[model samples]
Target: MLHLDASSSSNSKAISDTCNIDLNSIIKIETQLQDNPYDMISLVFLLYDVPDTALQRLIVYQRVMSDVSETNINLLQEWYCHASSRPNWQHELLEALMICQLNSIVKSLGFHIPTMRVFYLSSDPFGSKYINPVKKILYHACENIDSTNLKKLKKSLLSYDINVMEHTTCEIIFLELMSKKFITINISQENKTDEGIMYNVENIVNILDKLNGLKKIVNSLRYLQSKPNHDTIKLKQDNTNYGVDDFNDLFDLINQIMPNTLENDD
Candidate 1:
């Protein structure tokens, strides 16, 4: 049974401390769904923050099927229509956690948002009933790439390490992972990492602002260009797993915290 005693309170605090997801980000996504149900949604999960969690959510397609589904929101459409849309927009692979989890919210609000590709960190601990329903509704979106851009993308991923927060900029590499259709990217935290080194939303936006291109996104001066990778990973000896299991844990935590959502105050 659920406890309400001091011990329970302590446990709750522990849970809150251990389980963290950007609740505001989740809420904002939900709110957008509430206001614009027909908009497409695309999401990316960074399986490096909270293992076994769906870290980031991006909506990439808007297909209003049934009346119940019509009330849902779509991210891809909104982004395209929005003044600041991300470049190389892939309208097929939207994230599933937020959209599926919010199905009730969508129906209550009287809308629907179709999902596309929502990938997982590595398959373990990342399994969810959500994945099945989402897969039933949408087709898979990634495979071995054949495009020349993929080489560049892989080179970029190598720069990212995907298992070590090597550079001062993590969010950048995380976003880069999302751009390459990766739902999660793992990073090593064995060493005492630098919060100062981890690029925050504002720093990334400033970088984009400095960029000569993508004038629209930069113009918004929005602190966040995209969602931050939120998965938490656990590493073992030899690190042969590198970060898959860790990323999977990230998903689990994401599943727990995403329901509450966080605000972008920082």
Candidate 2:
């Protein structure tokens, strides 16, 4: 359990923060997994976000091979190509490996898995499934939007059966979307913790882009980068669990993105 501490070196930061994998590393890793291409395919299967049926369709369409070993290897390579096309493929791959319990390979490759809190604070949304800064940033971006943008946002959600009210705040709209499962959070009810809720936020970013609010979000992130302390908010270390106030402060760090605009806006 390697946590991404604030003390990580600059060179390490370059590797840990990014989802990009070098060609040489990719080649070496693939070669190492030649002995168990089946495990490799399983890892690829986990890395894929789509349903298993989609993967089966891809396999049938691309490489319908009779030889099991060769087919598995080819499929692994194909999946690597597909996964690498995604912006956060490396992070996704690391997560997939963890899920597949490939600890030996993970250690051999020197993959560092950061805590969900660290991922939430990071600029990369794909680092963890945690819902925090990204969600809060989008929510703040929606605050005090003009009527035109509101109409645009409303129209976008019409397909999801979300009727945005003239006076509805961003919080209310997001809550509604979450309730309807249009916006999902990755949290387990059986093992609930203050670790933070996981969410897929790219859709929110796309919606904000349509409303012309993406620029504001970008600027807000730039502000956070300039003031890193604001982004690296320390959660209270009291109990094994956290209370409501601690959670509020944890997620509300995005409010510092643009105080005058997000906070004071009506």
Candidate 3:
């Protein structure tokens, strides 16, 4: 009878230990995510409440504008691969997840929500700190541009021997112009930076001035001698660092944007 009781007691302890072990075990997010790339990518994107435009701008700030994917899953995957190669990648992933309010994912990865605020990524990485006012204005004008005016603007580029394709958007056009040195930022003073950066807005302003609707957007800069505080411009910045792969992606975009021009050179 005592042997039977001892056996039952030992069996109970084993069951209790098993339960505690199950409760204490940590499940890694990567382990679950590794096999489900599509689902993982989609969840990140879906839960990533930040606007897609903001993400695109961040990509541009990182100089990986070419990786801009219209599709969310592709964009997330590209961003994930880029982030993974960087130092402190896990921290960054945690930061992003936290920003997205993805507590479950964070916990799954064995990270607790930081009690104190830790900014792995600033709320605005690509804001005024990096992009001067002139570039900021151009970015805003580009963002607000409509398809009709975009087509007109592209058609006008033909006169300058720059053929902007039919499918290209204003954002792409702006990037191409910036890449080719058609649009440039000239910083006048090391200090007093508010008035330091000068915009040679001539080429782009002139082109936009010719287009009926776009004229109102960029026309004010036409008369400003040095400091033009165009209230029409609003700025948002995305801060990310680009890797070699990202640079390659950007180069490909530049190539795509200026394919006709490149062929003409040959």
Candidate 4:
């Protein structure tokens, strides 16, 4: 019988984690695709990490277009011909092509605007990294908008019977959204005849809530993509932070979530 200590167990887990997709294999497949643009086999292997349904749709679109028009076929041929030799191929042309295809599919399927927005955000490789802060702010603002504290502040203003400008509400929302640590809203009242009352409201929004919102959005997009029927899809409303998720984790998650998408043809 073998006995394992805590340290040894941890080491074993680390070793198991190393079995993810090989970076060298990705590079080799990319090179092979560039060398032979007409190789559908290599193309499929290169797109091994994408969702199965998305890959199937692309294949079906390609087959349909091939039979539809000579001009369209020539255009695709030219596109791949250019892609094969293009420098910085993955980041530059590959992303653009994926976005174009996603856009066309969204339009053809008549996906609602909200669904379109979610897909568009997911398609952006830099979205999670760049938009995290903004998402967090918006999430927190939504959570705090009608809080009892905020309502009390509003009641205090109404008791003073001061006329608040429409711009004042906009300013309050803006301050709430832009706040990092705490938001302070101040207004000054001169007299009973004064049109505006003066007061300051301070509020704190949870950073964790914002991070959780971002995770929910990313996960929702993944769920939407995996479903066969877009008409029945519904975004989850939970605000649980899924972990300290990042772009690298997102890529790995996608690969893990759709493992059957990458089965090598026999």
TM-score of each: 0.21, 0.33, 0.36, 0.21
CA lDDT of 140 in candidate 4? 31
List ranges where model 1 is wrong by over 4 Å.
1-33, 36-177, 181-232, 235-266
Model 3, TM vs. native = 0.36
Cα lDDT tens digits for candidate 1, 1-266:
11111132233335334322233334555565554432322232311123222113222112233356554443333333431121111111122433334444332321222211123322332222222211211112111122442333345445445432332223333344434434322334564332211222343233334434334443332321243222221111123432333324334444444334423101
Q: Tens digit of lDDT per residue, candidate 3, span 70-174?
A: 322334444455444443333334444444344555544332233201222234421221123344445446556777878788888888887767435454456
- Please tell me which predicted candidate would have the highest TM-score against the true structure: 3
Q: What overall lDDT goes with each candidate model? A: 0.30, 0.44, 0.42, 0.30
Return whichever of 2 and 3 wins on lDDT: 2
Tell me the lDDT of model 4 at 100: 28
Query: With candidate 2 superimposed using the best TM-score fit, by how many Å does residue 2's alpha carbon deviate from the native?
Result: 11
The backbone clash count of each candidate, in order, is 59, 1, 2, 4
Q: Give the TM-score of candidate 4.
A: 0.21
What is the per-residue lDDT of model 2 for residues 10-96, given as tens digits with 9 covering 90 to 100? 243333333235455566667677666445545433443333433353345234334555533444455566655434445445545
Candidate 4: misplaced stretches above 4 Å?
1-128, 132-138, 147-150, 155-172, 176-251, 259-266
Question: Distance from true position, residue 38, model 1, in Å?
Answer: 11
Q: In candidate 4, what are the lDDT values of residues 1-266, reduced to their tens digit?
A: 00111122233334233322233434433443343333432223222222233234344444554453433222234334443342222222222323323333222222222322332346533242122222222233334344444444344444445222221232233332223213321112232222222211122222222333344433433332232221100111113222123222433433343334323211
